[model samples]
Target: MTKKIFASIVTICGISVMAVMLLITALLNGKTADSAAGHVRNESRLIASAVEKGGSDYLYHTDFDKDMRVTWIDSGGKVRFDSHKDADSLENHADREEVAAALKTGEGSSSRYSETIMKKTVNYAVRLSDGSVIRVSGVHSSFTAQLLKLINPILLILAAAALFSALAASMVSRNIVKPINDIDLEHPDAQKSYKELAPLLEKLRTQNSKVSRQMDEIQSRREQFSLMTESMTEGLIIADPKLMVLACNTAALKLLGAGDFHKGQSIYSLNNSDIFRRCLLNALGGRRSECILRTGGGQREVIASPANSIDMVCGLVVFIMDVTEKQELETMRREFTSNVSHELKTPLTTIYGTADMLASGMVQSDDVAQFGENIRGEAERLINLINDIISLSKLDEDSAPRENENVELFALAEEILDRLKLSAEEKNITVSLTGENVSMPGSRTILSEVLYNLCDNAIKYNVSGGRLDVKIAHAPQRAIITVADTGIGIPKQHIGRIFERFYRVDKSRSRKIKGTGLGLSIVKHGIMYHNGTVRVDSEADKGTVFTIELPIEKKNNEQGEII
Candidate 1:
């Protein structure tokens, strides 16, 4: 608006200056024309006075022509003399305005009038010595009118020039302002063109850029706010001042189990629960509140807070959170604590009972020794169970042992078979190790422990005369080790839970065999910490094959070799 006003003022000032200049020029032209005409009339009167004073001499001595009429009239209205014809034949001229004025005043005068031979005349009348009139009139043409006629064309040309100049000025001004009109003030190019504009244009551009930058900053802040809201993990919803749904997030959509929540959907429509509606109403009323809502699948706990200082479009932002899994885990933790206490108490009671009997010396010396050994064995079993529990806890923590070192799987498997060979021999189970030497980049102690546990379990659970095989092979990027035993194979239902701590296929059979039920769990976590996987294939009453694949050290191209 201000720019338009300034442009109008500039245009008006330009036209006003041109008009004032033209008016002064026209006035000067008129004054010059009037002065020239007056000078021409004075010169004509001086020539007339000279001729009248020397009339007889001019008529006799000078070569006066017959076509020229030279007459002298007296103040009494008589033609005193005529050069061309009889004096009486001429009309009286003393009564003429110029003649009478010259006779009375004795001064020369000029007048313009019509004559018989000419349409216009320039008459200069002068008084003679006897008070007669001598009038000299020139009838060449309308000289003053002719000069003025020439002025019209010049005036027309000047007017046309002025018109063209005004048009050109307008077009030039528009052309200069055109680029400025299209210039984006927020852009760098607008600032680059600052040196080209006039002072006013430069000022305008500076103001425009400031306003544009301010608007851009506001927009950037708005975008940042939007990103924060959208990227939030917790679900968010916004509503108008009237408490109508306006916007929601992906988490909200999943929580609602609906794809579309159009505008005007009530808070109750989202959950159809009184608790949610009441919470929303309380938030809308400027009271912050938190409510837990149970849906068909799970529970959602939402905290609603009133928004302060809304924009022109008033709205409120609501935050929501899901705590169902956390609640479930809390409940499971409490139950697990009770179950673990019960599980440990039975074994501790058995060990305590055997120790008490041996201390009391209730049996023969040999029997008492045997009872003491039984108590010792039971105590050892309890210690093993506690140690396994501790190991499983360490695995759950996912911590790497400090004893990690490069281990040779082939050597580790051979050592494990050597240690378990006696046990295998007692059952008539043949234990064999088959593979080329292969090395893995991990802890030797942990890897050896894993092999020992697998082999021990295979020998302990195997039927009489069964075969146990340990095979080690070099895979593409890992060392593959398999421990197969013809044991009482695991049932399908129990296979999935075999790696879980304290989980057993048959509780009674596992106890009878003195199994701590933590062997597979330890092996699984040990392999996992080494960036390996443990896979088991088993069938009831047949056998079980446990495969451990651990990554092998590779060259720059990640190609491993068999040692």
Candidate 2:
């Protein structure tokens, strides 16, 4: 900016100076030409008067310089005297305009002409006492020749002065522009110090400082907001008026499979699930909405709210929550309620029938005692089923792990195998343990319960003469425990719900075997409480394998103890 202004100022000053110099030079040159012409005319008049006073002999014999040519014309328009040539041979000057004007007005004058010997002629007319007109004619070169001689030095001096003034003006302008160019708009302390620019620079510094501070404050606020968004468990996304992704949180990226969500990427492209797309469109139209979206891997319940007045400029902020587990729990709860009612009804019916038979004396004396025992056993089974249900409900409510304690995984597995060995022996099934000793951080009671349940289930479901494999191994970062059984293998459809509370592959068969469906659910909850995962793989009539993985060392809590 400074350079541009300097160039403009310098250019204007240079042009003005040059113009004034040229104008003055032209005027002076004109005046000089006029003065020189006047001098020549005076010289011509003096010579003509001298010649007229002294007669024809004085004019004809006059000894002026050779550079000056003199001639005289009579009233008859004939040349009377000539210095350069004979009077009889000279052309008549009476017809010349200058000579005629001088003759009639008795005044001398000059005019330009083209002739053989002269470009211009100056004439002086004097009437002598003898009543004969004496006109003296002198020829000279063009006026341009004399003007050049007079003005050349003046023109050269003016040209030199103009050049010097231009050079000086450029230097001064550069000095004035340099500091201004170096002034930093980003830093208020760095600015021009010249007195002329002080006020403007000060104002600029104040405005720049204010803007910089405002930008810094906004940046700080943005960082805090980003931190809050990242820390949230729910996935968040913000879109533009066109339903394009503008901002997203860490949870959103994870939920969306770490997909790119840069500017101009349509919200629908992030997840093509129909429900998600509808939510995005509805939010963009300023409507708060919600939808459950199931993707390839998981399901998300999204709650979209139109942004407040500040964020209405774009679209809206959509909150996403992973509700797959919650939905499964709700389904399990409904199924559990229905199953418990059915299960209790069957045992209660048996007890009621047996007691009525005894009360009615329908059974023999010997069978009555047996019937009473059968009713007691059925009542006990009902009590156990109710207790298991209560325990499962508690585990579900307290999903968080308790304080961690080191537990011997191999010992726990061995104990569970011992407890179920008798049942396995009755069915002619063998229970075998494999792998090395392993230790993990978890509640001993929970670990023992998980192993007991898994082993019992394995034995109960195993076919006669089948084998059960209980393996405990140490992995890179976790302890793996697997229970595999050659049992009446679960169907593919039933495998997914096997760990759900009160779910059974064959309700009648499970009841005949005195199998409590809560076993697998208990195992699942125990493993989950230990911050572990349980997965099952099975094939119909082939076998079923249940694998549990638990971290070796639990994460430390804020109090610096394992949690």
Candidate 3:
């Protein structure tokens, strides 16, 4: 706009200056031409009157401008005297336009130009009384020559005018654009600007308002997306087709073991492992891919899916789940199935073999009773194994109803000790009960099983002459039970998995102890069902202590009701 304004001003000023110069030049040239013609006519009449008195001597004696010419011709068309030429060589004046006119009308005037029109001649003729003609002529500048004579001045004036126009145009253009430049686009004021620009300002204000709304909306959506992604427990990542990380959550950073994560960083910067790259590249190629990535923290399942738009793969979204616990559970399930099959097969095979031998009557009469006794013992072992299995299944599935009752921990500990008295005797272990007889709201059947398992494990694993102590205490809202045994304590490495089903510290010793390995597992699950916590303390070759704390008031557990 500024350039346009400046150019327009300069163009208009140049045309106006040139127009004024042309008009002035034409007026001056016209006045000069008229004055020169008048001078020639006056000089011709004076010369004619002088010729009537002083004839040809007046033409010779009179000194005029070098540009002036004089010619005298006789009535018979012969040139008698010439100022700038020989009278005999001059052309006859009888046929000349000015002289012919003067002879008929007494006076005549005419103008002629050179071939180039650069010089003009103004001629005036007069007829003398003695049948002769006198003519005087003067050279004058043509319009073209006059214009050429003023060319330098005209150019100088135009140069000065152009310089002035440039300066004035610059100032005017700035003034014309100043209001627009000063306008505040964020918040425009139309009243302070030109009235002609009010409509444009209003339109600008409207556009600003619309853009502001769109910007605010975009910011709001961005914040919402950030909040949602940040709150996710599963690791999430969004990447462009070039594998640049567009968005990532905290969980993704932790899962991928990434540090100082920033947008636009390559996904390989987070984890450059082969499995991660393979899955990501597959997704970038428009194929969904999944793989397990093992890291220092745990195992993660990475699922990468292509984000498609209009049949084109625009980007990718990756989901990472910490499946360490799930993998561990799967392993445990397989091991439990294998161990259960082995354990059930052993007792069944023993019972079947003993009964079959008795039925076949291959034994002599002296061994019949012994055979029967062996069969009964093996059968009882099978039944016990089945019962333990059933108990574990019930705890795992939580498919049985539980009836609430007030159960005393000390009494429960005493009852468990009584039931295990013979086992304790066989091991030559001493048993004792201590602490308050605290009672908590729970199912009596479940509480009995919990106390029995702990006490049973205490006696079963204790060495001969080892002491078993069961302590019960109560807090304001919880019942605490501590069962400690002076048995071969668990090793440090195996302590973490002590409560796992069929997980024995010494498998040979445990098998010889005449007990199933599901007792500790049952104890753990029963305590969990009661909304309680259990912890173990032990050292190799020393003893193991199991401490349990249960809420006095019934509360809902994760699986089912506490009752």
- Per-residue alpha-carbon lDDT of model 2 for 1-563, expressed as tens digits? 54565567667766775577567656765675465467556666777677656767777466865655666777666877776789898777777775677567765566566655435655555544443455445555544444455466656765776577567766877787777677776663433456777777778879988998999999999999999999998998887677777878889877766576665687776677777778777776778889987766587888888765764645678888898889887887788889889889989999999999989989999897799899998999899888777767777788444746889888888888888778989999988999999988878877887888888877888899999999999999899998999998989888777877777788878867885579888887777676677778888887889888887877533211111
Model 2: weakest 10-residue lDDT segment is 554-563
Which candidate achieves the best TM-score against the true structure? Answer: 3
Give the residue spans of candidate 3 off by over 4 A.
Answer: 48-64, 70-117, 121-137, 241-246, 264-269, 341-402, 433-436, 514-516, 558-563
Evaluate model 1: give its lDDT.
0.70
- Expressed as tens digits, the lDDT of each residue in 222-248 for candidate 1 is 788768867877788888877777777
Candidate 3 lDDT tens digits, 435-470: 987888887887888889888888877889999999
Per-candidate TM-scores read 0.54, 0.52, 0.82
Which segments of candidate 2 are over 4 A away from where they belong? 1-196, 227-233, 240-245, 257-260, 264-274, 277-287, 310-315, 352-374, 397-455, 462-498, 506-508, 527-563
Colliding residue pairs in candidate 1 = 405-442, 405-443
Q: After superposition, how far is residue 162 of candidate 1 from its true place, in Å?
A: 43
* Preferred candidate (TM-score higher): 2 or 3: 3
lDDT of 1 at 273: 70
Clashes per model (N, Cα, C within 3 A): 2, 0, 0
